[model samples]
Target: MREKIRSGGNAGRVFVLVAVCCAAAAMPLTFTGPAVALPSIGRTLGGSPLALNWVTNAFMLTFGSTLMAAGALADTYGRKRMFLGGLAAFGLFSLGLAFASDIVWFDILRALQGVGAAAAFSGAMASLAQEFEEGERLRAFSVVGASFGVGLAFGPIASGLVVEAFGWPAIFLLVVALAALALVLGAVFLRETRDPNAAGLDWKGAATFTLALAFLTYGILQMPDVGWTDPFVLAVLVAAVVFFFAFYRIERSVARPMLDLSLFRYPRFVGVQLLAAAPAYGFVVLLILLPVRFIGIEGMSEIAGGRMMIALSAPLLVLPIAAGLLTRWFAPAVICGTGLLLSAAGLAWLSQFPVGSQPELLVWPLLLVGIGISLPWGLMDGLAVSVVPKERAGMATGIFSTTRVAGEGVALAVVTALLSAFTQMNLGPAAGEHAAGAAQRLGTGNVAAAGSMVPSMARAAMLQAYNDAFSALLWLLSAITAATAVVVFLYLGKSADVIDGAAGEPGPLRTTVMDP
Candidate 1:
């Protein structure tokens, strides 16, 4: 009986890991797949540029903002309960997204899908902590990371093929199927786990933080269309600041805060957060922008564009695992910093290519960026909890994931706006007052629409303007990435040794090398 029980437990654990890994892959698949389908969606639904951007932004904003709250709820309730609930919600929302006839409906459904994703992801991660022990836990998390990489590696090409053969709706339908499978596995095999001493959810802190992020994203996304000095834009931006201040105050005051403000006091903790955000500017933005540039602007077929994207994402399949192995001989900080620096070089190299440059010419730079970012991507989850005490690992994980996703959403908005602004500037006096409108259209990959708006500008001239703006954007991103790399390296100095000594055992650097 004892042996039988042990065997059954092992079987259950395997199923749990499989379920969580499925959820992990589904998350990135949802993120990157829709990106590839963006042009198709826009063409089918006939939305304005801003509306189209919302399809991606809405999902990211809700997902990033609600993650901490979802984690808290998962702990207070049962992890299994939250995981199952999240999966159901996600599947339902995905179905709605598939059938959405208008862009507005699609954006709304997308936001709902993000909320579901946040809950499912938080629950899935929290459940892993319960199902596995120290060494086994590390391996479990690494498997999850690899699963995420698989999604990123193939999402674009898979999405392109699906969109071409079926339609954009098929992309969301695929997510629904994945979600359903995970949902069933989780419901049957996952154990119910909760924090026995968990405090109730911090509703106020969650609200304030969500509001702050929402307002900030909204203001930034609107900036290009309404201009910097527009009254409503100014109001929303100010509101964002106010809400952020409120969030800080609330977190400090609350007995059980969603995010512990005191964590920022630790230099290593701060460094981890910065590192979490670095990839957003350095790599994540490209996932979206490159697809638009390749298929929408450059007129590459969907399959051709997806194939090009493989160069940017394929390295993730192996580089993350390779980075994990290298950590045995190198400090996590050195590895992470070096990765960002490498990515910066790739960005700069990529900027040299013209808009219509040959696909082969662009491959090396894109591959370099992929390889560089994969190093940090693999270790960020481990580093997040490592920078804090073991007792605080759950909080630290929530904070890091939130930072990473929120940072991506904000980076996408900022880069897109900057690109539009730069394009307008590069248009010279020829486009005149219509420059902003034309730039907006061009930024969304609606080159023909932009030409229609700016009748004075030739197609060739518009493309040149966009190309110059893209180059400027890449250079700016490279500088920012390099600077961030230096700061992350400095802040994480010798802290790994300190953490290990304090714990009186192998710290996260030694044990949790690749937790995604």
Candidate 2:
């Protein structure tokens, strides 16, 4: 029987850990669902596109940068303590957003929300890695994956329902409520875990790492607005590169580093890291483009667009479980490889849909993409953790979490930049000069504003621009993802078990539990 911790024992502990971790993972993404309303929010608040872009990047930036530090502290102090604190912080910031009046203040609070998620996700996953072992550990991650799927599926639906009932602020209120629930559960049942040999805090390393990531992300986010060669963007990008170099050197010299630089030497570890980031980059495109495709081109309401997103989200609930169980027999390559191929195929096919295709036409392709992504979802998380010693769970998960979220942030910026470029190219100079605002409006499916932005341009021309941009976006993502699948399949080195650590030479696959 699964034992409950305190009242619930170990089973209860695991349950809460999974629940809390998945909620943390899924909650920020649920915020993405509100992107359906971003154009409206921008117009209503009189915010510029650049300022509104911050609204999205802010959460990703803080969440990704803070993860490693949060992991280090959780390892040094106690995972449970860090988690409770993070949950508290996340809930508070989410509450604060409900009161935010301006774009700047909203972005600031969103960053704080990312910070909280960093702590909560890293701490919660590390705690699970510590508390569970062998089969149970895999089982726990499977449940965690499933929860993520469900939560992702639910985000848009919930956003639609809540936004329909109240306003966008109500969405933050729901986040606050969910965060509070997680906090209560975590406080009551989570079992504390930390590295027994946890070393001193790496304050300098943490600062440098955070700054490097923040600047790197900032530069990337600024690209579309300021153009890539703009002096300010160039300077920040240069600083990001320098800071990253400093971070690498500091990590190498430290007696006990926040991040062990040697981890990259392992082929599987490297592959896992890439795998962590690649899918995330592609997924972020969907988050940015879908609401626009459904609402902007098709002239659907935000609620209808959200409901249609369920087509993409629902399969997440099942496919992860299927992939997890399939791992009992097949290698990660066969599972993840096949899934990636399918995902790429789905994306390529989806890209071909007519510009003004009905939401009903998207269901099959969305399902394909969802299932394809789900196949590799949990397997990767488990593999990354297994490759490290239990004591370094926080660090391992920290790296994984950072790459995934940071990839999302950078991906959004890159994809948005690409979308903007393609749209501009298709619009041509005459219409293109005036297309930016119209394109942005079109993306969110706000046809009224889009029409207003380019009254002289034909609605057909605007729709064509969005279609070309989206087609380019999806085709590019599919090719890249398919290529990544090839790399991961080959580099994973033909094994069901790729958990061999850095202390040993890479060897054959084995099902035995990995050692510290």
Candidate 3:
């Protein structure tokens, strides 16, 4: 009877944790689903492409920077309190977006939404790591992974439905309702689990770190427009570097830093963290390109394009569960490494799009990519957290979160830059009169003329550019995946639990019971 009760309690906690992750995962997609709609949004709001880009970039910049600080705060205060507070904030801000009349207000509200999301995600992850230590950590992590899959898979569908039913504002409003529901549930059942030894919040460290990340991300995002050599961009980049330096100096001297730099000293921690970022960014690229390629270029309807995406996303939902099961027997790195390779291979296959490529041609590679994306993300996260001391688990989570988001930001800029360069180079002088004229007219906010300006030669040139971009990204993924393998083999050493007597005593992983 005692064993049965204990099992029931653990099961209930897992259910609550999964629900929290699902809600947290949905936050980012609120931005992602609208990325393609930016062209239309800009026209409606009398804004520019730059403004639309900021709509997405603003949320990402804030979310990435605050992740570490938010995790620390959760540790310092109380996880459950922070979690509910964050959910409420997220809901309110998302609701604000639903009422935003213009682009400026939309941008402002999105930024706030990001802060709230950072808090919620950081708090929930910290709670899960604390709650599930030994028997169920892998399973718990896989649930988090499923939340991600569900978020990405369903976000577009929700956005489409909302847009069709009540326009774009409805999309934001729906998220608001979901977040509000999460807030209520979190407050009702969640419990406090802050580490006993967790130190006070370091406000100075948080501010400096936020500035550092914000400046860096802003500069990177604007790179496609201004070019990296522009004085303003260069200045911001320098400022970003300086802030990071200052942040590190402050962290080292503080009693309790927002981030613990020492975690990187562990090879498994570093390797797994690095592995996490590459694939995280890689999938973002795939998601962005596949829709445009399959639907916009291939003459498929929006619904058809979205449905085709299932070819990639369906497998994403399943592979993580498989990875979780396999991790019970195999080394996390080995399983994760295999997944990375598979993803790279799938991407390589996708990079070979023929002229006037058919949507059916892409099904196999997309399905493979779906599987590839899931495994690395699932396994690497477990490996990273397991290596860290429980005292710094929050910090570890923050670091992993920060890097993955940062990687995505940097990847967007780099990929956009590379694609622009390729398009320009491939188009040559003739494209100036062909594609350039049309793009310039469209970019300048002329909808009607731009709609009629599509030229065959321009389309061909753009497709070539896309092919080059995809190829370059595949090469990048291959290099990153190979390096991850070497790092895991050489630096990461043995899997956890397999490592016998260490040079020093490792910290005990603190486990806590919480109300479901």
Candidate 4:
């Protein structure tokens, strides 16, 4: 029976999703341990704080930029085939990181790893789309969303233990092992999902999109370090706009395109896209900011901070299951709207956290935040994909994925800049003296003076940075969510509406694809 064959296909799809997701799970883990040990790393490697910042930014920029191209590639090649190839590349690059000799090499390898990650995730999603019916899709999206939270939760703890015990090299060694295993599982089980005969590959549109993303991302990253008015930044920004315009032009004219630019004509699609960006920005920045807060401000050890951070993970794991179940009884918008409100509340609650607050005391906010984050993410993604045609699923998914990553990328840069600028503004003359003292201590090789000076100004600067950063992010989340609510009411339209070109109900409500 067709139903039986579809069900059988679902099982293979779910297995592939898990395998590819496992590779995605490996990414943040590679950074977590190193991030926790940043100060120690700087001391050991003779790098400046600025240089160390690249460790995270490089990976994010590359990951965010290449996703669209990878999606195009998956749409062209068979999704399963592309996915397995990506996993192989991912494993290889991750292994390369294990042997990196310096900070530059480490950062380079991390970027390459991100490239492989983009390929794997995009291809995996493509395969998933072909495997499951619309009714089961939300659950699959939930699993994917939850995997990110799980990875974030586990990576730091795992990385901390390894880094503290055997140093940063051990972290990548673990990645190598995970990558190798993923390759084996992926090749053994995954099946091709894309129909090669269905559509022509839009290489020109894809190239333009890639260059646009790269330019835009690099420009944003430079904003933090070089300031926005710098000629190079201006040049890149202009080039990005040009390329993005060119992309639109190409997509509009092409017979078969990578992205269906007309999708933006739907206000619901636009709303979800913007709404999706906000929470992503909030969470990714939170992941980076919180650990620093726990360790630097609250005086928790790196290991202790990593463990306490697990509180955020618990709800992430559970909320997706709750969302999946609720789909049977509730509408996606209702669930998504509620999730947005919860996320806003959680973030606002987190804003109340005073400097040096205990992690245990903030558990409620974490719970709200986790639930808030999980619900809208899964629902929004489901809603967005449901609106698009199956043939254009890769492009739809890519655009959505790009928005999510771009939001996070820009958010991190903006938040970091704001945090840095705000902290410096509030540093009150003492910062200069503190920096001088630290410099002298380092100059004279007196780690004690450096340590002592590090107490007052360093601690205060850090506290101020975390405080401003979290508060700004909270407000940003609120505004973005409120805007999303407006978009939903205005453009997302009546509940249970049918997407054009799809055989479905005539309301906003749509079913998701799931594993058998």
Which number leads on TM-score? 1
Total clashing residue pairs per candidate? 0, 10, 0, 16
lDDT of 3 by residue, 91-136 (tens): 8898887777799888888889889988888788766666666567
What clash pairs does model 2 have?
A: 3-10, 3-11, 4-8, 4-9, 4-10, 5-8, 5-9, 292-443, 295-445, 296-445
Error of 4 at 59 (Å): 2.1
The 0-to-1 C-alpha lDDT of every candidate, in the order given, reads: 0.87, 0.73, 0.66, 0.65
Compared to the true structure, candidate 3 yields what TM-score? Answer: 0.85
Candidate 2 structure quality by residue, lDDT tens digits, 1-516: 212344465657555765566465556454565576665566556566667777777887788787888877887778887888988888898888877888888888989988988888777776666556555666776667666666677677677677677877788887777777777777766666666666857998888988888888778766665666999999999999999999999999999887887777667777778788867755656865787667556767768878877877787778777777897899877788788888898899899897768667888998788778878875777667655555554466668878888788778767776776677667776565566666655544566766786788887877888788888889999998899889878866544354453322123211122121
**Collision count of model 1:** 0
Worst 10 residues of 4 by lDDT: 503-512
Off by over 4 Å in 3: 1-15, 18-22, 129-141, 292-299, 354-356, 389-391, 431-467, 493-516
Sort the candidates on TM-score, descending order.
1, 2, 3, 4
What TM-score would you give candidate 2 relative to the actual structure? 0.89
lDDT of 2 at 123: 74
| Model 4 TM-score relative to the real fold | 0.82
RMSD of each: 3.8, 4.6, 4.5, 5.8
Q: Compose the digit string of candidate 1's lDDT tens values, residues 98-129.
A: 99899999999999999999999988988887
Query: Model 1 TM-score?
Result: 0.95
